[model samples]
Target: MTIPDRPLEIIWDITYACPLRCVHCYSESGRRPSRQLRRDDLLRMADAIVAMRPYGISIAGGEPLLVKELFEVTERMTAAGIQVALFTGGWTLRPEMVGDLARAFFRVSVSLDGATAEVHDRVRGRRGSFDRALRALDMLAGAGPVFGIDCVVVRSNFGQIEQVCTELVPRFPGLGFVSFGAVVPEGLASRTGFAEHELLTEEQMAAMGAPAFRERLRALVPPGVHVTATDNLALQMHPDRIREGQFFPALQIEPDGAVRAMPAYEGTVGNLLTDSPAELWRRSVERWHDPFVVATLTPVRTVREWAEATRRIDYHFASAADRERIDRRPAFAQL
Candidate 1:
């Protein structure tokens, strides 16, 4: 069946509370500042999302499972015919939660940065996190969810991509996709001292771009398993066809209900709690012509350059020194 035309997609960060502290976290999410919208407010935002009729909604978080009434929000979106995708750390995902998630979400993408427990535990900054995540994956597999693994390619785990695709993917029968991307040095990553060493080097990034490496990656995955690379800045350079009811294809809804264009958080179009979805959608479309927005949509040589240019265009997002730091980093530093 063909899908109906709708707005691009929405990445809704339900909360910033997370159990594990990964080095590459873009939002720098943690357990502190346990601030999130009330249940009623979330339902209201869900209603707005339904009204907007986005093609897909990615329910993300510091850890989305930490949010109260998460399944209620998921059910609401699903009931309205919105395709919901859950992006989670899987640290807090328990067996009991698997049934609900399997029924509600169209897909679940869990983070798995390394092949071995030692590598993963160190990357996640928590002991036994790898075991817990593996258990959660087992539960999800048993519960019959269309789940996948998201590996953040970094200096420590870059060599294990083949193992992840060959060994890990086959272990989980429910696994349908494996996504890989280099770490982006933004948010908490920028502040963390270890981010410098964790980021993929210029030589590494160039090697990843080489045709031979790409072919090898494709050859590593088994049949029936899909592999995806998360770096798609070039795809976002062109503005959506406004006349065809397509605006910015994706948006980021913060835990506070503020709606902003994805990958760029300097400007807020509107609040999901206070404004109607139509109004917010209109604002996003209008802002597509804003100088900063236009500049951001323009393509650059590398992802780090794109991010630095994006920050420079928005004075309110970061300071001159921060932009300089970001610019000085290697191209794929903020992948």
Candidate 2:
């Protein structure tokens, strides 16, 4: 499928230098060693993305908060009337920092692996990350801007999803949503952690491979609260919602200003600093047919026409359980 003319969201991975070294990090490429994007280069890319007029922009990173000029980025995006969302582990959400974040954007998303401190801290590989994340959440609560939490479901935290919904929803009643990204078989995640039982098994896949899993997930979340599953998980588990009326949704721009159709693609769509939004859109549409990307994006195409027409690409699923559920949906019945 071609890239949407109007983007639902754009993700900016401003830097890759995170404080805590989580085992499942997708940006593991940064952990080895990295340099931050220059201020001028980042500002230029922001201008290009604003020109696209996307509904929202998400600035994330090893931790976006670590970047010195992140405030400028958020200020600029908001000044342009583009809604902005910041994705971070929330380890840095100190009182002073929370005030700063509240002024810069429309929403702030803090990562939480588990509802309790024990599960969260262990997953994040830091002593006090969970406490800090909650502190951040507390700091942001009832501030003008919306607040949300993001987490990656791994074998370690898979069974805790329900608890998270139950505990977090009421604790932070103003929280707008919970965002979940199932483990992607890439970067550091592919390497370490878990036995098969700990992971999503074929049986779980078969049992949960339908909309019921997501619906149940919705039920567990606080009433009226929203939820998002990024990447392939969104493809298999959330396609119906995306199609029903949600939105085209997020994109990712790397430090080099390359706009990926999604954050994980990591290849060049076009340099946001130099190219016009229309040009980048055209280029992404062109590249969508590349055997590689087509296969990656294939799981989202339900109709035979879509599948036959699609060539190559990869997809994201939130968990083995989510993928199993996704595979079982009746989307392909007509196909």
In model 1, where do residues sit more than 4 Å from their true spots? 1-6, 190-196, 202-215, 234-248, 286-288, 292-299, 310-335
**lDDT scores in order:** 0.70, 0.64
Best by TM-score: 1
How well does candidate 2 score on lDDT at residue 71?
Answer: 88
| Backbone clash count, each prediction separately | 1, 18
Best candidate according to lDDT:
1
Q: Model 2 off-target regions past 4 Å?
A: 1-3, 191-199, 202-211, 214-224, 227-231, 234-250, 295-335
Q: Tens digits of per-residue lDDT for model 2 on 1-335?
A: 33356666787778878888775565652454444678887787778788888888888778888888888878888899988888888776566676678889888888898877787887787889998888888878888678888877665677787788877766886888887666553334432232222334443433234566667878887777887654343422123443454334456676667666544433456667777777776665455445555454445433222222221122342335424432433221110
Prediction 2 TM-score vs. true: 0.75
**Could you tell me how far off, in angstroms, the CA of residue 313 lies in candidate 1 after the best superposition?**
4.6
> 194-226 in candidate 1: lDDT tens per residue?
445665667777766566766677688767677
TM-score of 1: 0.81
